[model samples]
Target: MERRKGTIVNVGSITALAPGPWAGVYSASKAALHALSDSLRVELKSFGINVMTVAPGGTKSNLGNSSAAKYDQTHDWKYYKKYEEGLRARTEISQGPGSTPAEELAKKVVASVLKKNPPAWFAYGQFSAILSVLYYAPLWFRDYFYRLVMKC
Candidate 1:
């Protein structure tokens, strides 16, 4: 009734492609996962294992609320105290009005993963396309764009 292989799906983030001002650690972690998945896709191929990386953008989830709650707990900003509001706003960036519905993203992921020949890389959600494009943009341009949007 069902067929399942040894597939490893790493849930990455579109943020990995473009590191923003207040989300350094989150972006870095996702970027690291992307790198790991890339390597594993090849390394595990001979063993009949497939690795897929899903890079989701602003999809509807409780992550924004959780991030906000965590940010609320931190009071010591020191040198970065003046930009607290912007930092807080960054927490809710993925949960904005334009955010993708979680169900939609789930459906896409499931459909892709269930295919006979699954893809090695997949990205979906609100800012997915733009962020993918941003991956190819110049460093200076990306920096200016992030600074303008994140208000850093």
Candidate 2:
């Protein structure tokens, strides 16, 4: 659709806004994607292309199971061994009951992208709002809350 102008939808993660424990690399990657999307929106505007950044929170899927299955929790850490359970739990945390259904999120994203004037940023899924709140919260508050909840 280069000639007709098209929308470029980039899927990111809500964790990019406020990274917590055991997911620093994942969060940083998503954050970089978000930043790239922002830049692309400006750079591609004259080309009749729309850039949208969709930051999903936690949607139900096999991600947790796959991660848990592939992860080797047997690794012996020198100092962070005490937090092993917490690290292991990170793989399954997004699969909790509160996660949004993957199909539901997909439908919403499709509808949004098809709109005549799609939003530049769309975020949905479980913990989406809470993470947004944490993004705006004070550093100390975020640190304490993440420590309490993640046990890291």
Whole-model lDDT values for every prediction: 0.87, 0.90
Q: Which whole-number lDDT from 0 to 100 does residue 61 have in model 2?
A: 87
Error of 1 at 32 (Å): 1.1
On TM-score, the leading prediction is 2
**TM-score against truth, every candidate:** 0.91, 0.92
**Model 1 steric clash pairs:** none
Give lDDT tens digits, candidate 2, residues 1-152: 36858999999999999999989999999999999999999998888899999999998889788877655644556466688788777878889888889999999999999999889999999889999999999999999998998888
Q: In model 1, which range of ten residues has the least summed lDDT?
A: 1-10
Q: What value does the lDDT take at residue 50 in candidate 2?
A: 94
